[model samples]
Target: MTSIITHNDQELLKLIGERQNHQAFEVLYQRHFDAVFRYVFKVMQDRETAEDVVQNIFISLWKKPPSLNHPTLLPYLFGAARNQIAKEIRKNKWNKEQLDFIENTKGICSTDEYLEERDTRKLLESGIQKLPQKCRNVFKLSRFSYLSNKQISEKLGISVFTVENHIKKALYLLRQSIEFIVICLVSWY
Candidate 1:
């Protein structure tokens, strides 16, 4: 058994593609699973859906390992996540724009409801503003700039794993902040 720990991505790919080494593949999967899962979960925001997509991605990798000439595995994995998320969005017929419009229109039937919606949005924005600087930057790059983790990593001079962790942390903090805001608003009303 090779010391899979010492194998770089190309070595791992070669082992999987040519030698059909299951251990090499398992090593690759173990190395990247958390980052890939976190990346997909950031987009899907549903544990089950993210798990399924990550599973499909790893399965596809096993079926067809990418070429050895490719630079790093992180970009390819993140691209696959983006593509899979896009496919799921298409399958559900609910792109973000459409979802945003639907959500915006929900309370348009009444002025008070519209005001409440505005307040909720403001609260969410405030929560975002309170994020730690790096976390906020990573989150914006991933969500607003639509940059993959690899891109953000390169641009920020950080690791892909760091980018993923920042994003995950940002999401957790934001969710908690929003939930607290909701509770406060409910209590006040």
Candidate 2:
């Protein structure tokens, strides 16, 4: 393993750009392998997928090592990882849609359905802050605090029915709020 220069990752980039500095590439790989793997694993959730992404990322690096205007390779690698994650997510989503379309001729969520579902979920997550106090508390317990309704009942010293109602109302309010946001977005756009 080569020691990283105190400053300037471009040392390796420069070498690779000027001449086919294979050793410099080796140095770049060693320095960046762990970080790249960590990044892919953070996104992909599967070790095998992460490993494959890392391999692809490096293969790209070698295919065209560096140009005079090359940006810092470190950020470029991570940015590429982010793009790969998005691509993988979208690919899987489309695959699921394809399966659903084949299996259910009567009804299927189109691309709009998936986008709206995702946006609604995002809105609900962000708008929980605006829920009525009791409803918000129950929602947090069930979703974030990871408490069963029975446990929530004990903790809040409320009837089980009340806890259940709180959860129901919370969900209703969340859905309504998200719907409102979606409507607003559509109107504005």
Candidate 3:
């Protein structure tokens, strides 16, 4: 396993600018991904969107090395990210407007109460999707089959505590996903 050294941004830029410094770029990628991503996320405030922006930023960096125009490369990258984030904000605004329009115009009575909130449902579905397969199956069995934890454990051939733990983890992830969605929705304004 190649251990990564923590290179300062200037060191990274110099290495990245070199033709044979692939390892340095790799190290830089590992080092700066989280910081740059968090910076983008702070502005964009959406993980999926931030991920996309981060990927794009790194890709552009690889494709086009920093020229002399960017004497300070980290800030240059951050500036690029900021610009990308502004574009994303504008796009999100347009999307929210369209979503709101559709939601408002659609008769509330026409929608089933359970189905009216797509974002929440998607959040839950995504949370469930992220679970380990066993945990997901156990959670579904408990929820859909309406079985007690003991029953679920028996059916799954696992201990009751395991079943309970799986269910708890699933619920925790779902709650977290929902909270994130709620925060995003609230922050839309």
Candidate 4:
């Protein structure tokens, strides 16, 4: 068997798409699996779902390999992965909203308890806002944007170590502030 490793992506893609060479498809899968998996896992945040998505992406590639040039292949794969992730998120959100609506209609909680929960959530939000600028940005990217530490680093142009430190500091500050709020509330009670 000719080693597909030495072949450029263009050659490998042509072999798979035009010639229907299954081995060539295997080589493409091996080459791009880790990168595609990481990107998917960063967005999905679940190992099982991410793995399934990656497999589906590869299967799609095999079934209908685009006329992707070598230089554009990785970006194309990433774009597809992002699109899949967006669709999954939308589906999950819709399901959650339906459940929330059903539960709310059932009158699960009293008005007072709902008010307390809202106050607690507001306090947490304030605590997050009190974080130092860089720390807050990193924390928001990690939590709200759902970005991995490496992705945050790349987007923010910082080292991964710095991103980790910022997240840790943000978390610590928020925890301390929340604890203080709880203590004050308990003392009042």
Return model 4's CA RMSD, one decimal: 17.4
lDDT of 1 at 86: 70
List the RMSD of every prediction in angstroms: 18.0, 12.1, 14.8, 17.4
TM-score of 4: 0.48
Candidate 1 per-residue lDDT over residues 17-99, each given as its tens digit? 99889998998899788767876776666778889999999999999999755534766776676677777777887568644
Arrange candidates, best TM-score first: 1, 4, 2, 3
Error of 1 at 15 (Å): 0.7
TM-score of each: 0.50, 0.42, 0.42, 0.48
What's the distance in Å from true for residue 86, model 1? 0.7
| CA lDDT of each prediction against the hidden true structure | 0.79, 0.69, 0.69, 0.76
> Which pairs clash (backbone N, Cα, C closer than 3 Å) in model 1?
none
Worst 10 residues of 2 by lDDT: 100-109
Ranking by lDDT: 1, 4, 2, 3
* Number of the top TM-score candidate: 1
Q: Distance from true position, residue 89, model 4, in Å?
A: 1.3
TM-score (C-alpha, index-matched) for candidate 3: 0.42
lDDT of 4 by residue, 110-137 (tens): 4454457558868978998899999999
> Which of the two, 2 or 4, has more TM-score?
4
Query: How well does candidate 1 score on lDDT at residue 87?
Result: 76
Give stretches of model 3 more than 4 Å off: 1-7, 67-73, 94-189
- Candidate 3's displacement at residue 186, Å, is 38
